[model samples]
Target: MARVYISIGSNIDREHYVTAALDALAGWFDEPLISSVYESESVGFDGSPFYNLVVGVDTDLSVAELSARFKQLEADNGRRRDVPKFSPRTLDLDILTYDLEVGRVDGVELPRGEILKNAFVLLPLAEIAPTAVHPVCGECYQVLWQAYDRDQKLWPVDFTWQGRRISQASAR
Candidate 1:
C-alpha cells in the first residue's frame, strides 16, 4: 500500500462538507490520520472562509486512480466546474504526496505545489506528519512548517466527527 496525504477544504457549508469528506475517505481507505480542522481566508479569489485539513491514507490505488477518485468525490459533494478556478467550492480535495514519488506520476503531481505555497495545506500536513520528509525538499514537514511564511492566515477550529472531537480551536 502507498502511504498518501490529501488536503481537504470547503468554503460552502464548511462543517457539513468537511464531515462528509472525512466520512467518505474513511469509507474508501483505512481510517485516516486526521489533522485539526482550520478556518482560513480564501486564496486566489474572494469568497467565504474555508475549513481545511489534511488526512493520511494508506491505499493500494495509484496516483491516477486517487486523482480520479478525488474529482469524483468533489463532484458528488456539489463542486461546480463552471465557476472560476479560484472561486468558492463546496469541496476541494488535492493529493499532497503519494509515497516517496516525485514529479508528475500518472498525470498527477506527486508533491503538490500548494503544500509549500499555502498555509491551509501545509499546517495541517505538518500537524499530522511532523516527521515525514518532503519528497523534493528532503526535510521533515515540521521543519518546513517552521520556516513557512505566515502572511496567509489560518487557524484551527473545533470540529467533531462520528461523535468524537477531532479538532479544537484556540484563542486567536
Candidate 2:
C-alpha cells in the first residue's frame, strides 16, 4: 500500500463539508492521520475564508484512481465545475503526495507544487508528516515549514470529528 497525503479545503459551509470529507475518506481508505483544521484567507481570489487541513491515508489505489475518487467525492459534496478556478468552493481536495514518488504519475503531479508555496498546504502537511522527507527537496517537512517564507494568513480553528476534538484554536 502507498501512503498518500491529501489536502482538503472548504470555504462554503466549511464545517459541514470538512466533516463530510473526513467521513468519506475514512470510509474509503480507513482511519486517517488528520491535521489541524485551519481558517485562512482565500488565495488567488477574493472570497470567503477557507477551512483547510491535510489527511494521510494508506491505499493501494493508483494515483489516477485516487484523483478520480477525490474528484467524485468533491462533486458529491456540491463542488461545481462551472465556476472559476479559485472561486468559493463547497469542497476542494488535492493529492499532496503519494509516498516517495516524484514528478508525474498516472497523469497527476506528485509532490504537488503548492506544498512549498501555500501555507495552508505546507503547515498542515508539516503538522502530520514532520519527519517525512519531500521527494524533490530532500528535506523533512518540519525543516521546510521552518524555512517557509510565504506571507499567507492562516490559523488553527477548534474542530471536532467523530466525537473527538482534533484541533483547538490557538490563543491568538
Best by lDDT: 2
Candidate 1 off by > 4 Å: none
Q: Which window of ten consecutive residues has the lowest lDDT sum in model 2?
A: 22-31
Global lDDT scores for all candidate models: 0.94, 0.95
Clashing pairs in 2: none
Displacement of residue 166 (Cα, Å) in model 2 is 1.1
Q: Which stretches of candidate 2 lie over 4 Å from their true place?
A: none
lDDT, candidate 2, 1-172, per-residue tens: 9999999999999999999999999899877999999999999999999999999999999999999999999999999999889899999999999999998899888899999999999999999999999999899999999999978989999999999998999987
What is candidate 1's lDDT per residue for 1-172, written digit by digit as tens? 9999999999999999999899999999877999999999999988999999999999999898989989999999999999789999999999999999999898888799999999999999999999999999899999999999769999899999999998999999
Cα-lDDT of candidate 2: 0.95
What are the clash counts of all predictions, listed in order?
0, 0
